[model samples]
Target: MRFKEWDDYIDCLLRQVKFRPDHDDIRAEYEEHLEDLYGELVSCGVPEDEAAKDAVRSMGDPVEAGKLLNSVHNAFLGWLERLLRWAMALLIVLSVIPLLSVALAGGESLIGMAGGYRDTQEHGALVYSVPVGESVALDNHTISFDEVRLYEDGVFELRYRDRLHLFDRAVKWSYDLGFSEVRDGNGNTAKGGSGSGGGSFLSRHQQYFEGFSPDIRKLVIERRGSEYAYKGRDFRIEIDLSGAKEAAGL
Candidate 1:
């Protein structure tokens, strides 16, 4: 190879060395060194081919040099990766602090709110009330009453100590869209067995409430324009009152 040919090859090799940190300056210096070597070879009467081979031999392997350069490049990349991870960790902690504070300030203790019911019932002009504690073992289930009357057709409220349950099953099922036709004892629709369905879930739910009465520990009744309070479990719904005549009948 002539001096010009060898210079062209070195230029191409330098262009391919992407990982070289100071490629331009190093390539220029290498070119000058090759020029000096070519002058020496020409003065010594050495052929161009032999001088080119000698220059290439003196320069160590390009592949090994490239590997070392790549190692340096990857080390920089690794440092950048560690810096990014630490920054991300700091950002995540900063984001979670406000959420934790909000949760604590809400006073929404799961264990504290889980124990009894303050129930209210109203029938026409009468209102019956009770306070029942949850069973010893905490069961997080909502049991509802199908025919629970609020003033017979008025206002009802449900309360729970450890969990929520249903006081008015009719409204609950209605809201839940659990409507089904009223079925008779023979598993057929009632009244001439026409089977024409009505959008009332209570007709089917009554069966589940049968023989399943909770012990009413205390009772408060507002009936016939008067209020009556009772202690202990009692199935008897007494109707004694002294007020407006309508309350008397209530």
Candidate 2:
């Protein structure tokens, strides 16, 4: 139960508190304390009116109390504290957004590795298949050749995976496994190929070439040229196709 005396005392106390922004909070605190004190006094057999008056009196002079509270809750410090809290919140949001993006990209990469391989295999009859499983460390990436598939229609497909090192992953930078130059054992270049790939942190890649020959005993895949080609990194993968030729009955 609220009494007029308690209301009047709190109003007077709040008038002396210079920080208007904190008035509501301070008022609530004082009201809660007075209610508790008033309840305790009434439980001990004091009359309701007397209990209310005693609770207000026990709080001491409102003016002096407000002055002490005003000193403690400096307006400038209150505003600075609020500003720092907001800044910390913003910093947390900024940090988490990139991590979420990397996680999402990593998920998409896994899905692409599974789905894209299945889609490519459906295009032609399987003539020869080999698991290369070779890795080369270049720049900020460890590029691994997972498998190679050649179809009867001269479609050559290479499945590879690449992972960015810790530092590169932290900065959200990615490595591109660009077009590779394919050559036969007799130094004949295989032409006309297209590539597609996607991912972050760790990524899967697929490159397709046309006019591959089953008679070729050796195949050399080389990545070269400017940053636009293979991000300025050079590496060679030499694959012996003798087994592929025998398997395909060439």
Q: Cα RMSD to native, each candidate?
A: 18.8, 4.5
Instruction: Give per-residue lDDT, candidate 2, residue 235.
Output: 76
Per-residue lDDT of candidate 2, residues 57-163 (tens digit): 99999999988888988989988998999999999999898888867877877766665544454447888888898998876788888787787777777777777
**In order, what lDDT does every prediction score?**
0.38, 0.77
How many residue pairs clash per model? 12, 0
TM-scores for all candidates: the values are: 0.24, 0.71
Give the Cα RMSD of candidate 2: 4.5
Q: Candidate 1: worst 10 consecutive residues by lDDT?
A: 203-212
- For candidate 1, what is the lDDT? 0.38
Clashing pairs in 2: none
lDDT for each residue of candidate 1 in 165-240, tens digit (9 for 90 to 100)? 3233333222111112222232332221111111221111111111111222222221122243222222212212
